[model samples]
Target: MYICLEGIDGSGKTTQIKLLESWIQKCGIDVLRVFEPTDNEVGKLIRKLLQNPDAINENFQITLALLFAADRTVLMRDITEAEALAKIVISDRSFYSSMVYQNDSEWIAEINKHAKQPDLVILLDINPETAVSRCDGMDSFEEQNFLASTAKKYLELADHQNFMVVNANNGINKVHDDIKRIVAHKLGMCI
Candidate 1:
């Protein structure tokens, strides 16, 4: 099973993921927790390029889309295959981040054809203002307007069955419990 957690930076996704990982382990399931923009060679370059504002200057949209796609390719090839020891793989960010950042439905759809879809995608839905306030490491992308637009794009293109919007504005434990409930129903695991 592949479970992904996504949201704007400050939405407490990492906290929830950590909590969920602990909870799942307590349930006696082996889980592998992973994050995108992995630390591998190609992934390292991609992460550097994305974090550097100047790198986004030339052909912004195209650059962003291609970099994300490349990162996903590396991840899929290296980690998501049958050799994985854990029965469940949980990712902090997946293709949904690319779709939200690019804001192009057609592009996202095309990419989805090649990308592996998560069995469950938890979108920690938080308004931009709240999102910014909660975020710790402020980058250019953390600006309120940028976050709001990205989040709106995520909501617009997501399907109900595969995607869920959780109220992340609530405290971390509340959000974690909500996510646990969702995973329990989808994976039929004891909580």
Candidate 2:
């Protein structure tokens, strides 16, 4: 099973991933936790670009999207290996993030055409204001208007059967419980 968790900054995706990892382990399942941009060479470039505001400009979205696609291609190989090992792969982000963050262009879709889709995509839904308040530092894409737009795009691309939008405003435990329920149902594991 390939499970993905996505949300804007401060939406608690990292926290939930950790909790889910523990829960899945307790269920006697081997879980492979992967994150994008991965720790590879291309991923390193993406991380640097993210931290250096001056390195990004109007065309940054296009560049970043392509980099993300490259990183995902590398990640796909790892995912296949983990799956062959019978481990459930859980990713922090995936192509859905590109669809939400990048410009609405066919190029974005083309870049990610070869990427594998997640069996389940859990989108942690939170208002931009709330998300901004929860975050300590803002990235280029984490600004109010940008996050608002990203959130809108996520909703627009959401598929009811494959996607679940969990209210991130809820307390951590409550949010985790909600995610756990969804993951359990999808994976056919008892929670």
Candidate 3:
């Protein structure tokens, strides 16, 4: 199973992923944890661009879209291998993020067409204000307006079947409990 956690910045993806990993491990499922904009050179370049305030323009979005596609292409082999080894691969982000973060959705989809789709995308939905408050406000994308736009895009992508939405406005444990129930239902595993 390929599953990914999606949300705006500071939506608790890191926290929830850690919890999910431990819980799934206790459930006897070996997991392969992968993160987007991986630690490769290309990903490093992308990170540098994101941190540069000058790169927060329209042109930057296009550049980031391309970089993200390249990064995902490079990561695909690892994902394939992990699945072959019967490990359930979980990712911090995926091609879906490009669609949310970039301006031209159609172009983002085209660039990411070669990327593998997640079997499940769990969106941790939260208000833009709440999300920005949790972030350090250092990155180019941590502003409330940008986050609100991205959050809306994420909700539009959520289909409630494979793309499940969980309210992240609640406390961590409550949100996690909701996610656990969703996972149990989808994977037929006991929580």
- Clash pairs, candidate 3, are none
- Overall local distance difference test of candidate 1: 0.78
| Regions of model 1 farther than 4 Å from truth | 55-58, 82-86, 108-112, 137-142, 159-162
Write the residue-wise lDDT of candidate 2 on 1-191 in tens digits: 89999998788989999999998999999999999999999999999998876644768877888899999999999999999999999999888888777776578889888899898999999898888888877644548888888787777777633589899989999999999999999987676
Displacement of the residue 176 alpha carbon in candidate 1, Å = 0.7
Name every residue pair that clashes in candidate 1. none
User: lDDT tens digits, residues 26-109, model 3?
Assistant: 899899888888999999999989888778788877888899999999999899999999988889999888877777778888
Query: What range of 10 consecutive residues in model 1 has the weakest lDDT sum?
Result: 77-86
User: What TM-score fits each model?
Assistant: 0.86, 0.92, 0.92
CA lDDT of each prediction against the hidden true structure: 0.78, 0.87, 0.85
Please give the lDDT score for candidate 3. Answer: 0.85
Candidate 1 on 23-133: residue-level lDDT in tens? Answer: 988888888788876777767877777777675464766776776777787777545663266567788989878777765657766865667888889988888888776
